[model samples]
Target: MNTMLGFLLIMKAEIIRGWIITRRYWFRTLTGLIIGYGMLMILIAGFFYSQPAIEKGINQLDDPTRATNYILGFIIGLFAFGVIGMFTQGIQGMAQTGVLEQLCMSPYGLVTNFLARAVVASVTTIFYSALMVYFVVISVGGKLYFDPLPVIVLLTLSFINLLGFGFMVGGLVLVFKQVGQLTIIVRMALFALAIFAREEFLQQGWLVSALMHALPITDASICLKYVLVKGQISETGQFMSVFLHPCFYWLCASCLIWTFIGISLFKIMENYSRYKGTLGIY
Candidate 1:
């Protein structure tokens, strides 16, 4: 109970610190919001505008509703990427700023503080995602089929998998002090998994489809697109359908497995860094 209370306090402090930073640089904040979100909206518009061929392809599926599914998937994926990247880059930033050494010596421990900051950051991402979605839907003249409960549930699961990925990155940063190349590869892989998996051409073969479905964030993206753009609510009263679905189950299993791997690897790297007396080294 005491530990939980302390964690909550730290989380609150972190959130306040974030608000202070944002407020102190309100212009930068506004500029970042405009540029980042504007770029996303513009790119999405460009994709659909330039590629009427894709629309024709979806029309071939006899599902006219899919006209906007890819765009929506990209939006959701971008949101997820932002949330996960915030955590990963926060850890990396600590290293770059020589804060990791102090954090290592703190009573709260590096992992605890990192997780707390990440949770706080992720809480705000929900609002960011909603605002982006609202603007995109309005601007694109697209309809949304929002089932709040399922969307929340699935998105949370997806982020759990991402949290594990963040842990891995954090671990690497602890040991290597720099992983620019690895980071790029991981980020692009995530982008592909989340954004490109929606392509029907990739659905060929049992093995290929299974692999795509099992990829982290892919299934969640599909289901989220279904709920947000297609109006298909599998169930709200019962949780069984969400769990029974292949994508959903894959998400759960992958979260469990990857989280275990991530934490274990991070712990190992943290200990090694400490043993080497380089925990503070950049």
Candidate 2:
């Protein structure tokens, strides 16, 4: 009970720290929101409008409901990016600033520290993503599914899966000290797969489809799109069906396995760093 209380306190402190940082940079935060979301909306809207072939292939863009899928897919994509950034780059930032060693020395542990910060960052990311998605949908004259329950369910599942990937990246950063190029490749590749992967192909038992599913967030993205756009609850169905569905079930299993592997790998790296007495070195 005491340990749990201490952990909670540490997490609370980390969350408060994030709020303080954001508040201190209020102008930068506000500026990033306006410029980032505005530019993305213009780019996406213009590209689709210009590319008749792509637009036709995707179906009637003028149809608000049908367009929701495309918009929501980007939203999920942003969250996936967030998961990657919040862990890998989050750790990288600490290491560069010589904070990782101090964090590692904490009695509460580095994993808890990273996770506490991540939880707060995830909340901020979701809020920004949702805001961007809303305006982008409106810009394209697309109707958004206003239901929060399904969206929350999708986000919860996606976050779990991505958290495992984040752990893996964080572990890599712990030992390597620099993984910027690798992270970019991983992030972009995963984002592409999540945003534009063909559902029909993924349903097939092809090697490519299998590979895509092996990556975190791919299956969840499909399920999320189904829920957000097609008015479907799960890509498969409701209740037990949600659990039984290949997409959801595989995602849960992958998250559990990856998370385990990631934490174990981080422990190994942490030990190695301590042995070398290089925990503070960049």
TM-score of each: 0.84, 0.87
- TM-score for model 1? 0.84
Worst lDDT run of 10 residues, candidate 1, spans: 58-67
Name the lDDT of candidate 1.
0.69
Model 2, TM vs. native:
0.87
Each model's C-alpha lDDT?
0.69, 0.73
Tell me the lDDT of candidate 2.
Answer: 0.73
Residue 223 of model 1, lDDT score: 65
Please give, for residues 206-261, the per-residue lDDT of candidate 1 as tens digits: 88876775556777776676566656644363334444555666678888876887
Stretches of candidate 1 exceeding 4 Å from the true structure: 49-67, 199-210, 233-244
Clashing residue pairs, candidate 2?
Answer: none
Off by over 4 Å in 2: 46-63, 233-245
